[model samples]
Target chain A: MAGIGDRISGTFFLVLGLTMYLFVNPNYIESVNGGNISPNTFPNILSIIIAVCGTMLLFKPTTQQAPDLRSVAITSMYVLLLVVGLYAMSKFGFEYVAPVLAFVIMIAIGERRLHWLLLGIVGMPVLIWLLVTIVLGRALP
Target chain B: MVELDTILAGFADAFTLYNLSFVLFGVVLGQFVGAVPGIGPIMAMAIAIPFTFGLDTLPAIAFLVGVNKGGLVGGAVPAILMNTPGTPDAAATALDGYPLAKQGKPLKATKMALFSSITGDTVSDIVLITVSAPLAILALKMGPIEIVALMIFAFSVLAGLIGNSLIKGIIAAALGLLVACVGQDPEHFTPRLIFGHWDLFNGLPLPSVAIGMLAISEMLRRMSMAHGNKVSSAIINLDTGNPNDQRVTWSEYWSCRFTLIRGATIGTILGALPGIGSTAAAFMSYAMAKGTSKEPASFGKGNIQGIAASESANSAVVGANLIPLLTLGIPGSVGAALIISAFMIHGLQPGPLLFTNQGQLVYGLFGAMLMANFINLWVGQIGLRFWVKVVSAPESIIFSSAILLCIVGVSMATSGIFGVAIMLIFAAIGYVMSSFGYSLVIFIIAFFLGPRFEKSISQSLALTNGDLAQILKSPVAVALLILSVISFVWFMRKNNQVNKADA
Candidate 1:
């Protein structure tokens, strides 16, 4: 039997294909070659391909390496951290938020070494800040 | 006929101190990352694209090319010393390299790899310099119908040849095409999927999409692993006091000349075709070497020819990959895709017209590519020791710092936070796609080619009034379409047989 990922992706593709086909308004598809083809024509064809692929996977699924829950959790944590970090950087300046964010990310990735942690937290931000602000003359955040 | 004066003028342009310094810097940086496991050249280039925004077109490309070429040389370092390949392309190098290191001949293995790699790269670059112009000129004859058929053929070859499953690869490619359709319809410029957000009219930023998928996704994957990059394999001791063990005598180096030539030839051929990557080339060359050898069993047990075969072929792919990119605007590998994106970013389109219109720029790039090969050799010889030390850095700090750098890069390239948001979203999508066994490389290649493909299709439709029968009239187009069908079927059978064998 196929894994949960295969099933989920299969369903996702089926839904996506159906939505694209059903929702692409005719007004948006400019007709060309006396309406023999349009911009929507390719997407319509792609939608069919997408649907067939989904149906094929449903019936004849291939083996996929199942991702672990812990990995998912870790990825989620990083995403959450980035979202919050982006929010935080928007509120505060990048210089203020960057070091703290860098430090947290390092900890999240299992970096417990003191010097390495220090370098990542302090060295990374300073280097990036100097490069962006001073060298490249680009704004941050 | 190829002009000598233009070529020499290009050499003069590349000889400038500004360009050469960036190339040197790029090679050094490439070696640094390539020594470390997990952070390969593709990830580095994706992240570094934004840094080139402030530089000129020539220096910017020179830097990235140098990084790419340098990474190949540096990848062999950890493969020889630690038995862990620094890049996917170098995985086969560790087969013989690590064993030789265990025999207290790490230097000999590394040096031979360096020499053979330079030889292969040089050979491919010469081929690229000579043939790409004529090829591009030939490509000029292809009409919209032929271009449409050619791209379909490329996609077919790519879908079947890349990744584990053809179905999954197709799904990924289809998804990429869908995502690419988000901004506007290519023919009439009608909005298709932009959800009334005016900011999205320009489409998702390339740097954002690319870096997010390639770089952040990789870092996320590493962080998700059990031991992650922290699994420190035992590093083989490098300096044995014996001088004979450290040196590759002239006879030993000369012995692998034919093996080097064969590997280079294989790599060059494979690299010319879209999507047969250096990893495949390296393994293919290694297989060919072992298959043709008198002592096949000696392969995994520290064969010098094995190292020569793997390194030469993989490195040769770098130069040969540009053949299709420069000639036909089709990238042969992920690395070449990045290079094409870089070219596009610099306001230069890489097609047949690029050769005809921007002849000087094209020649200068060629000169720079040739220059990168020599610099890669020199830098590899000196920096091998430095990179060996860099290999020991813990992956935790590296990944953490790298994620921050990626945000910086994307924001700079796209001019603000909007692009960063796009990157974040794509990063999540990339993680899901990767976890689901979809090919990220295929998705990216498809995404990059989608606009061109749609345009060509639109043109073909206009030309033939959407008549399928008309496409059959063009012999070249019909031949390509048939080849695509044949290739797909052949690969399907091959994949099934392999799966059955495994089962």
Candidate 2:
């Protein structure tokens, strides 16, 4: 399973590197005295290196230590759910969704008490707002 | 005369109210983060990086230096109380610390750790101040070729230091460099590898990368272990109900004084060297102490002396690592990188010329390093009990909070949705790597050197007109290259031997 994960990730990088080379061609600002190297040169070099490295990973595969699959699946699901909540809240405003999301995560992670969840669920956004608006004075989307 | 005056000026700058405040705050916060399990000094440094954008460089650095010193002491809190070490460096502390706690003497063990940490760190800081400038001066005389060679030496050393599997370590490092390439090229000012996103223009933000690779990945790993077992919270006897409990005696301190000193010395030397980290120093020192000790069995079983040796040595490295960073521009550790960032932000360049040109900044940084040890000693002593409680917070709660904080921290930096996406992707990758027993050290350090390596190689090639021999022309470059080769070969041989034995 772990080997498959590495192979999949490695192959994805190879494909991504190819795509980056194909799609991204940054136009550089040319100078009067001497035209410098374009922005694309570095990335193109990077793409080739990445692709090569990824392909090499395919051949000389190291044995991967197995993970506790159930735990990983649960945690990943929780993270996925949270990410979805964040994206959904982006529509209704983060102020509305962030606190609830934090609360759900806390509960999911074993905060069994309802009072603690309610307090955290409500208190977290207010705290974040105070930190951003009153202290740092940065606008949070 | 100028050197003497420079030292005086540094002291003057460091003694100021603002610098003192920054140092104090950094120390306090560092200790807080350190005491918490799974959050090391590097993570604290990463999280603090974004906040420094608002401050002047000197104060910004003073804070980070304090944190570095304080982090060494902070990890000992959990190691002593809960048997769960906050940082890898504190793993040695756990050997003796948990036994002490089990014996109903956690407070004494904790206090001994505090005292030894202070003593070792103070001594190392003094030594660092004496030696760092001369080394930096030597480094500054070297040309671009030597610099590139030095960087390669550092990278190779870092890779070798990580774990048993050399190729796996290299792969992780390569992955880091790849991620680092996501940002715009510094030399040409052209965006590289940013797939139609303006956010990628700046590259994967360092803090986001850090929070993901170190903080979030750790949280996930911890959560996996924690879900299977109930977090055993046996309230150990802190008050020492038994009056006969063996408190840390003056005689014990005197006997272990040499061990503490030796450990500190080892830590200081290791910390000064790039890639050899505090954890390595701690283990090396612990082994040395045990090897030389008359009572070797006393170690790994509630020996206050063992705790003292490990804690002090590891803590001392915090001060020693800064020696190279301040005097020379080269970062000796992740913590030093934060200080370097602070310097860059404040419009001060680190190196031999920095000491000559920005004498006050050098002096100020040095002074802050010294003062932070005292601050850590004072602050850590007072906050001992509170820190223990903080350390023993349920692993589940801790991991959850870490994940939440990582998400929030990343979001805070971008202010948009992009960083969140980046965090998830990196977190998944990090989790996958962790599952495979792959070390993230390579990834983190590779990410650190990526831009510099690219710039140095290109610039060196430009100067030599693509003559690769330029790397070997300079004696310094040649020496560093040889050292890298020797180290790389040694690591590969060792890895093969270990694998054969395992098989």
Candidate 3:
């Protein structure tokens, strides 16, 4: 009865655990024969536990809610835009990218009102800039 | 003895106009965010934490405490009016609240919830102020082995109780532990999991992780919903202006006195314990109140006592949860965990030593908590109409603005866009984990405590010369280990029973 989400998550964890166990380094120079309780010990233990949990999840017959693909798609698109926006910020500075990101996100989320959109695009970035630069005295990225 | 004078001085500090304004502002903001359906207090607190960097420790902590307290009262509003609890802890309130609202007494139900919340919260704060000092004093005597054993017990309790599946909870905790180990090895001062990224030498910034998992992931989840603004349709009409239906008489309040007292006591006790969250406390109190009621069948049919039981218990949890955080350095709830991060950001380590090292600030925080209770009551009464309007505002705007705020806050705190990138990564992880039913609370808490766990175990190993037999020499550590084993077995048995029943 395990749903697609559980199966997918199980496979993910299993792969991740195995990869970390096989590849990650956990030793330091000060340890005795890589130390009985070296840094790797905890991570190794955790990896084993996760791998076991993943195996159990794969085999366990339990009900799970199905993932919403449509919502996932929309959220992915939003995240993609966000990443792009961050890149743009790096290129053109926060002041330029902030309002544009806000405007695009508001529209994407279905905000149709012009005034609200304007407020978000124009007002939010300026307010945040003032708060960061003047009040907190922190440099904007 | 000195604690008394520190407390008085704290009261004086908290009463200043500058500090009081922050408390008021925090409560107001908490109520607004709590009244909103998709956003909750934890997210609000996360977004607000970066703002506290500029303020002194007292005002900053006071502001955050006010937000946490205000959220307790504000959550009840949506439960009473719309039958949609704003926070998970307030879900039990809707059982009786919606029915009461339907009987044309929405105002009455909201007022009852508010009064009971304030009363419960104040009493819990009193318990916290009184109990935390003694507990911290006791904790000061604990060795590394005892601390290690105690953390194991906490992990077991959290993994066992917080989420539906114990296996998933443990898996989440394991993931958290792995993530926590990404920084330098505490003992050797060498990098453990930092993959050639100098920025990660300090490990994953806490503010980024917190904002990502709690706030950004939540926004992503809400965005993914088909009916994006469905909560807007659940708004109730509270403008009836009927004086008779609006006010709760003294006799009515007195009638539910026993229920409120019992609920508060239950919440206080449960909140002080690790892993038993406010939601459980509220439901447990509601069940007990119903079982003891003269008319049990009226429980879900507009019974005021039902509202009293749920509200009092949940609100009581807000203050009582701080007990373990301040005393043992273990966060008893997600809110407490976030507060712990704030403490770290402020350069104040929370635990037994906090009382001795920073007694003035600790007592100041206590005074602030007391003041927050009064602020919650006063602000909640005057701002009800304003909050109703706020809740109805477009979700797109709120969430979009939230995105902007997250970027601003993270960028400001880390002074770089790198934190934003880290936040997005964790947000994706959090979204996936939550969608699959893993407990984010357990994950975040484990992450927070992971370093401490490693330090304690390493210290204990050094002390014991890697001999397990030496750990048994400490009676306190032995007792704690036994208790941890018992808790693990009990929770496993309980989980199996639940699975069997489900099957």
Candidate 4:
């Protein structure tokens, strides 16, 4: 199980390193000033190190404590939910999206009690609003 | 040497009502999260950093220090009462603590842990106060080549010493350097890898990256562990109803004085070095205590000194880790790294120059640290019962609220929605890295030190006029580089031996 994940991460980093070195380095990192040390020198060295390490890991992966696939999937779901929820908050004012976000995440996390639901949905966001706006004098998105 | 008036003024600044109250709040919050499973001080510190933007520097830093100190004390509670340790550093505390709790002496175990924790932390802080200024003055003598070599040593030790695989650790650090290169290069101020996004023109916000990776990823991991029917939180009954188990008498406390001293010594020595964190200190102290004890068989079977050894060592690390951060601007752990950013946020640099430039403020931070130890002692006495109760907050609600807090914190710390988006992305990256057993702490440390490392490299290059062989001109640089190579080989050999034994 651990080897599988290690191998995958190795492949992932190898691809990432190659992309950064070949594509990102050429296009994104422009040489505005040429000095003794080029602007891209550090990153290029980093990318090569990453690629070499990734290659080493790919060939001879060691044992590690990898999380189960179910756990990873659950966390990924939470991440997607969070990304979508924050995007919704930006689209519709935080006042509207926040409560729903709170309510759904609460349900997803297995909160079934009514009072806790009401408080999590309505009370928590209001408290945050008060703290951010009224107390700190900052606006929430 | 610091002036008497400067020290006196720092005492005055730290003793204010405002500073005291904030420190108390920080301690209370620290204890709360420390007792609660699935959350730790780094997570708390990450979320709190953005909130402290409006506060004065001393109070803000003092509060975070309080949290870190209080966390060590509070971590021992869950380790004692339940078999589950609240923080990784507290795992060794459970060996003796749980047995003592099971023997109907929960109060005695907790009180002993709290007392020894405060004692060890105080001892470490006193050393920090006495030695830090001199250390900082000494650090001022190092040239750019030496600093660069020292940074290399830090990287080698951190990547080689931490985590299961040195390769994975280095990969994480390399990725951190890559991400750190996203903003404009320090030399030319020309953008390197912004991908045409102007928000990243100022670089990825530290709060977004730190909070997302440290706090949100941990929360997500905890949420994943919230199994069916286990999501509500563990409820352990602490009512043994024995009067003899309610307190630690002076004799009981004084009996383990030597053990506390030894633990504090081990912790302070290791904590000052980068990459050797409190968990290692705690376990090392526990092993040595058991080995040297007169009654070695009583170690895991309710020996009081075992608790003292583990708790004191872990707690002492909170103060001792700051020695490197304050003197050399190198963070030994994630907590110290966060404090460095807090200092940077407050327009205070943490290197040796801070001693010469902000003498009074530095002393004030010292004063606040000492005051927090006293406050932590007082609060731990009163809040032990409260912290035990705080651990019962449902994981579902706790993790959800943590996610919300991370979003809000990053948003407020940076621009509103854009920062939140970056945080979510990093949170995902953090989660994946976490799943694959990479050390996110190493990544953050490398990311935090990346700019300075790059600057040192650039400086070294310019000084030697791109002649890399000129590095040998400085004996100090050569010595540090040799140490780096020696440590890397030593760690790799040790790891191989351990792996072979396990296999």
Q: Pairs clashing in candidate 1? A: none
Residue by residue across B1-503, what tens digits does model 3's lDDT show?
A: 23678878877898888899999999988888888877878999999998898889989988998888888777877777877788988899999988988988988888888889988898899999999998999999998999999988898889998877777878998999889988776776667777777798777899999999999999988876623342244556775778868877899999999999999999999999988988999999999999999999999999999999999999999889999999999998889999999999999888999988888888888888888888888998888767756656677777878888898899878768999899888898898899888889999999998888988998999888899899879999899889888988898788778767776
Candidate 3 regions exceeding 4 Å error are A1-4, A26-36, B226-235
> Which residue pairs in candidate 2 collide?
B10-B363, B10-B364, B183-B203
Best by TM-score: 4
Better of 1 and 3 by DockQ: 1
DockQ of each: 0.54, 0.33, 0.50, 0.67
Model 4 stretches with alpha carbons more than 4 Å out: B227-239
Candidate 3 vs candidate 4, DockQ winner: 4
- Give one digit per residue, the lDDT tens place, for model 2 in A1-141: 435544654576577667655654333222223223344555566666666656655554444445667877976876687678768766786677767676666666666655556556666567767766677776555
lDDT of 1 by residue, B1-503 (tens): 34677767877888888889999998888888988888988999999998998888888998999889888988888888888899988989999999998998988888888888888899899999889989998899999999988988988888888876787788888888877877778877766777776677877679999999999988877877723344443455778999988777899989888899999998999999998989999999999999999999999999999999999999999999999999999887889989999998989988898877777778888888888888888888887777878888888778877888898888889887778888988899999889988889889988888888888887888888878799988999999999989988988787677656654
User: What value of lDDT does candidate 1 attain over all alpha carbons?
Assistant: 0.85
Where model 1 places Cα greater than 4 Å from the true spot, the runs are: A1-4, A24-37, B1-3, B226-236
Q: Is the docking of candidate 3 incorrect, acceptable, medium or high quality?
A: medium
- Model 3 DockQ reads 0.50
What would the per-residue lDDT of candidate 4 be over residues B1-503, giving only the tens digit for each residue? 67889888987898899998988999988888888777878888999999899898989999999888888888888899887788899999999999998888888898999998988899899999999999998899987889999988998899987888888888999999889988889788788899889899878889999998999888877776673433555566667676778889899989998999999999988899999999999999999999999999999998999999998899889889999998999999999999998998888878888888888888888888898899888999998888877777677666766777777778888968999898888888998898887999899999888888898888999999989999999999999999989988887787677656655
For candidate 4, report its TM-score: 0.97
Model 4 lDDT, residue B31, Cα: 85
Tens-digit per-residue lDDT, B1-503, candidate 2: 12777788789999998899999999898888889877777778766665665677788888887877788789888888878788888999889988988888887788788888888888888887788777777767877777778777876777777765665666676677767877677676665667667778878876667667766776766665565454555355567676435356788778789889998899888888876888888888888888888889988988877887788788888878777666656677767765665565466666667867887777788799888888888898788877877765555455544554555556666666678777777777887876765667667767766777778676777788777876666888899899989988998788667756654
TM-score on alpha carbons, each prediction = 0.96, 0.89, 0.96, 0.97
* lDDT (C-alpha, whole model) for all candidates: 0.85, 0.73, 0.85, 0.86
lDDT of 1 by residue, A30-140 (tens): 445544356687788888789889877765556664677788888888888898988887788688988998888777666777888899889989999999999989998
